[model samples]
Target: MTHTWALVNLKPGVGKSTTAVFAAQAAYEEGLKPLLVDADDGRSCLAAYNRADGFKWPVIGLAEPDLHRKLPDLDGGVDLVIIDVPQVEDHARIARGALRYADTWIVPVAPSHYEVDRMFEPPRGAADDSGRYRLLEFFEEVQDMRRSPADVVVSLNRTNRAKRTKTGPDAEVREALEDKGFEVLNTVIPWHDDRFRQAILPRTPGTNMRRLVRELLDRKGATQ
Candidate 1:
């Protein structure tokens, strides 16, 4: 069975594109055919695929608002489809399309108080907004539109594992998200300059990312 996942966030620069690329790489390494779709106008994933020398899976840029309708024609017999969705604050239509199309939604967030606060911030613009654009609230709307509830999980990225003790910021943030009703993935991606902060692909991933992909696959399997 093919799995479709959309990496989303309320704001940009939260490792959505990076997670999408690395997850696809890990899936390929695990002998799965993964199709990466760059639904953000930034096209970061598509650019990374183009710059890399030997990528196992194919990546295409589809930054259209009607992504849900268009992606079915491009499945190409792949085992997985990972979408790098644009931020909901600025690109609600594109984000919603991806949300509607995916069976799983992975939200990558850094371990910090500010990032946690921003997740509930109302989206920019809108004269008479009623907080529908907020990340969690927007997900509620998307859930109503879907035929079945998609598996929504949060991936803790850019973490300082050295400081992630019992009462660390990472732990606090994880607790907060869970309190608000979110399935926080057990895998926490640590901060590594060579692996995460640089251009994606064409390099070996660290153990954390490999574990994250394995956990994601396990979640998908359980739902199936």
Candidate 2:
């Protein structure tokens, strides 16, 4: 089965390229022909894919974000294509374009109030004012990309394990997403310099990157 995924959001500084590069690399590692499509002009993921050497997969850089008109062929040899999109005021346009061809859309939210609020804003506005209660449920119903059952995952990235706050922004946002029956990834990518440094280079996913990818691709409840 072919799967196309887009890592998107209107939120910037939230590790969009990192998630896109590795997820495609992960698909390749699983013996699939993965294609890394860089939707942003930043070329960060393309730079990383070029520097992170020893990749057994093929990653293509698409400077344009409109896959609806740009993607030439997806079913021929591409088993999976991961896209890194721009985080802008209207990224919802590019994201919606990606969703036109995506099997899943992964919105990586950095563990912070600002990031969460920004990430949830677009989908939130679609919500009906149910007195601010059960608002997340309304968000999910409207956020589904495919009428055939869309899988929109809210993944927490750049998390701090050392920090402990029971009812913080991270917990609350995640709770809202999960309360609506969304499948949240269990492994949160830690905030590390190496990850940012590695983003400049390209090729294969690192150990930490691979672990997080496994968390996303693994069975719903099975232990990794």
Give me the candidate number with maximum lDDT. 1
Q: Model 1 segments beyond 4 Å from truth?
A: 123-133, 162-165, 204-206
- Candidate 2 Cα misplacement greater than 4 A, ranges: 51-55, 63-66, 69-72, 122-147, 162-173, 176-183, 199-208, 219-224
Residue pairs in candidate 1 whose N, alpha carbon or C atoms collide under 3 angstroms: none
Tens-place lDDT digits, model 2, residues 42-139: 78776776676636666666655467567646546777678786764445466556666665667787776666555545344445343342224333
Error of 2 at 207 (Å): 3.7
Shift in Å, residue 125, candidate 1: 9.5
